[model samples]
Target: MGISKHSIETLKQTLDILDVIGSVVELKKSGSNYVACCPFHDEKTPSFVVSPVKGFYHCYGCGVGGDAIKFLMEYEKLSFVESVEKIAAIMNFTLEYETSYEKKPDFALLDEVMRFYQKNLLNHKPSLDYLASRCVANSSIEKFALGYCGASFETIKFLNAKGLNKTEALEYGVIGKDSVWEYARFSDRIIFPIHSPSGKVVGFGGRTMSGANAKYINSPQSKIFNKSKLLYGYYIAKDKIYKQKKIIVCEGYLDVIMLHQAGFDYAVATLGTALTKDHLPLLAKGEPKVILSYDGDKAGINAAFKAAKILAASGKDGGVVIFANGMDPADMVANKQINELSDMFANPVPFVDFILQHIAKNYDLNNPLQKEKALAESTQFLHTLSPVLQEEYKPTLAHLLSLPIHLIGSKRLPQHNPLTFTTPTQEIAESVLIKTLLEKPEWIDFALEYIDISLFVYKRAEFTKLVANEHQDSALIALMINERIRPINDLPSLKEHLRLFITQAYTQILSQIPHYTGMNLQEKSILMKEIKTKILQLKKGELLPYVSSSTF
Candidate 1:
């Protein structure tokens, strides 16, 4: 009735769990699995392990383990279907529902129109001259698939000859309803094809060439084209962005094209809008360092300020570079100032520093009321960062406002509850083993088949309640909250631990047989021989079949 099970399974099979997790948290290669500081909890050391082969991630510190869909549901606070919808969007996979689904986009029509525009650009002299004037190299134009659409009649006549449908054209905003071939929507402009991450052209960004007109336009908002979600030139720059581990965010398409031409191929631009929260998913991909390159003008600075807050609050690593004196990346590259541009991009103010500076600049710190206002704003901004980052930047904020470091940080800095973990390692291991069985009740049947509850010497009360599926015991509450105690994460490790417990149980049984009161000597001898044979088989690394019974 919701999402088909087959489609969900297909998504799980095709989805790359690393790429999905890597989008939200920065993962570094360590040995066989990728590791990072657990994003779910505050920790100084990295204990989150992502196993690509197993297609899941486990955080040893916080004990959160799941595949890609489970991760999205937890971190994003989405329902099962919503999480599936998000993964489908990221992977460019279509989700088929049990009843019906949304219609797919008409990419063939877009491709045909894209080719038509490219052909028109080749025959237009002014468009070519405009590119030459902007220092847009021939190679750059070809690489980005930059093209030109012809004048009013010229655009209308072509679609008419191709017999394109009127309704489909109107639905995609390809043309308007008019006497002239439905008013050719992309009339008389230079077009930059906008593509999805997988390099499928989804929409277009059109620029007017007239000296009197310097405005840019986009395809009307449709199911296929969303300006907030799509980044210009991202389809081309993605591979380079992944390789360099960096991405430059600029103001215009020309800035991206010029930056790429100047050897900074890992550059992309917002689609005529400031960066939005929707863009975070794209920025998180590859965990790239986001460099905010904008002009030093008031508008640009304000835009960068908003962008700085978003990036800093979201835990993005990178800086901001202001291109002062009205010169943008396009101008700098055209003027052959590659060295200066390179130096500027190489050194940008860190996000938190930039946010602090921007917040402080708004109020005159010399005034008492303004100084108090600045302190409040700074503290609020500091709360956006992790506790580690907040502490790291406290001194900087304090110095900026000419105040003591004690007055800095949030009104009440977060403090971890004091914990005493004096329990022995054997006790912890037993508690964790019981916790594992408690979390998955179905596994308790298998656990009982192999190991007896009497082995739960350290956590017998907790184990008893766990088997009964009750949670009233105070000891069970402490057991779950103890971060020091963690169950084995993966399947293979769980099997090995269970085998060790089985051997210990057999060993315990062998010693207890001679003390039996109800058994005759002959019966004791038979039980003793059977126990010894089982112990020897276990020593040979043989696995006994676990039976389903109630005789734990």
Candidate 2:
């Protein structure tokens, strides 16, 4: 609910800045106001100054300048509404809500509902058996307040007995439909209670024991519970997160529980959603290093990549660990691989490295054109980071693309030019290759056997038009009229470029062999051997006959 504007104005007009900031910061008299070390950052020289007259504070060191309300938002990590409410409460002011949030999400009713779910688990043998099978100890279950809510119309009866109604149940997502009493939102599932940062139970996460339902489902968004803003098991992990100055984010509730049970208690999971920018605020608190642990699957890898980009861009310290094979944290813990798991956590792929690798993986390093695209993508992502980070990761990006550092973002890569954009050897080779194809159409069929369409990125459409026998496009016209259109006239020089493209394509295919996790050992071994033999032949200046498809 939003606070009334008049109430906010009153607090801004009457509240004393000195009293508000002085309560948190150790301020001393400075001529007419106060001065202290900046609380937002580390500074020993006391560059932070507070002005009672202007009712604001500014730190010369970090340049974080703000008023009392802004100070609370930064220092305490509170939202604007939270900051206003906090200071208003301190001044004994009754802040009016813009919308009547008269009936808040029935906190007491939620507590009662959780207690009933816990009671239901103790009696449900199937739920208990499932827990036992997963190696979940009774103590761990009780400690986490794990529970069961079966489909028996029992939850409705119990809530009715407690004098609660459908409005509260539907408001918090206990029942599927709000208009009438119906089946529970969660049935035949193991319930994991999600808590507020203050350790109050606010919502539920259900893990389906039956394979018929989605693997997991979280409580619907409510007045107080936003899954994107809440992390599972955070209430338990917060202390360790602060102590160790690290947090391990995972994909599921069992992953967090297993990690905690395995003695790695600084682990939490997103509530059935990928980590988002909304999560950054809570993650910013305690200044902890963020580690993301995910399953070894396509979705998991994509999630980890997105999270790494966000964390890296936001300047959060962290790394990523994508479990190999089909393994996950829960599987590893159950398999008694604690040492391996700990080692993985201790030395995860750093955020910068993970991001660079993920982007590079999408393009073939052997293809000169793909390499340029890869470099451009890597540079774009790098620009989002701090300048120091951008500079630091540039060499790393260069190494990933097998290029010299000077070539990356050296100059803006031109769009319509084929031969004029000098620099970046890949572009030079591409322009040479395309000029060869355009001027000497006789060599087109010969080169078609060696090069993929992706080998000509800067002038790919022009190259495609040339291959298709349509020579009237403006881009091709521009290439033809350009002064640098001196195409290779000899077969030997053209053969040299074709050999490089062929060898790189083979090498790229070879490099991705191990990543074909779905392939059998024998099949992968045969494919690797064939690709290696072809690459070896190409390196020895031997030409192989093959039809190159449009795709690489």
Best-matching candidate per lDDT: 1
Name every residue pair that clashes in candidate 1. Answer: none
Query: Which residue runs of candidate 1 sit more than 4 Å off their true CA positions?
Result: 1-13, 16-105, 178-181, 211-214, 411-499, 507-552
**lDDT of candidate 1 over 1-552, digit per residue (tens):** 588899999999999887688776766655446677788889966767776765767766666777788889989999989999888877778888888766364666778888889989999899899989999999999999999987766666776798766576677676778564357677778899999777777888888876435478888787668888788989899999999999999999999999999999999999999998778878877779999999899999999999999988777899999998899999999999999988888899998999899989999999989999999988888887778888899999999999988888554445432233577655766877876764555677866766666666688778888877775344554454344566666556656777666666677777887887878899888877777787788778765543212232
Report the number of clashing residue pairs per model: 0, 0
lDDT of 2 by residue, 1-552 (tens): 688888789889998886578666756554555667788888545667776765767665566766789889999999999999878655545677788753243467778888998998999998899888878878789878999988748877887788887787788888876465477888778899999766777899988878855888888998668888789998899999999999999998888998999999999999989998778757765678999999879999999999999888767788999898899999899899999999999998999999899999999899989988998888888777656677777788888889988877632322221122456655556667776777788889888777767665466777788888876554554444344445678999899877886676667667877887768899888888777877888889998744332122
State the TM-score for model 2. Answer: 0.60
Q: Which pairs, if any, clash in model 2? A: none
Off by over 4 Å in 2: 1-105, 178-181, 410-552
Judged by lDDT against the true structure, how good is candidate 1?
Answer: 0.80
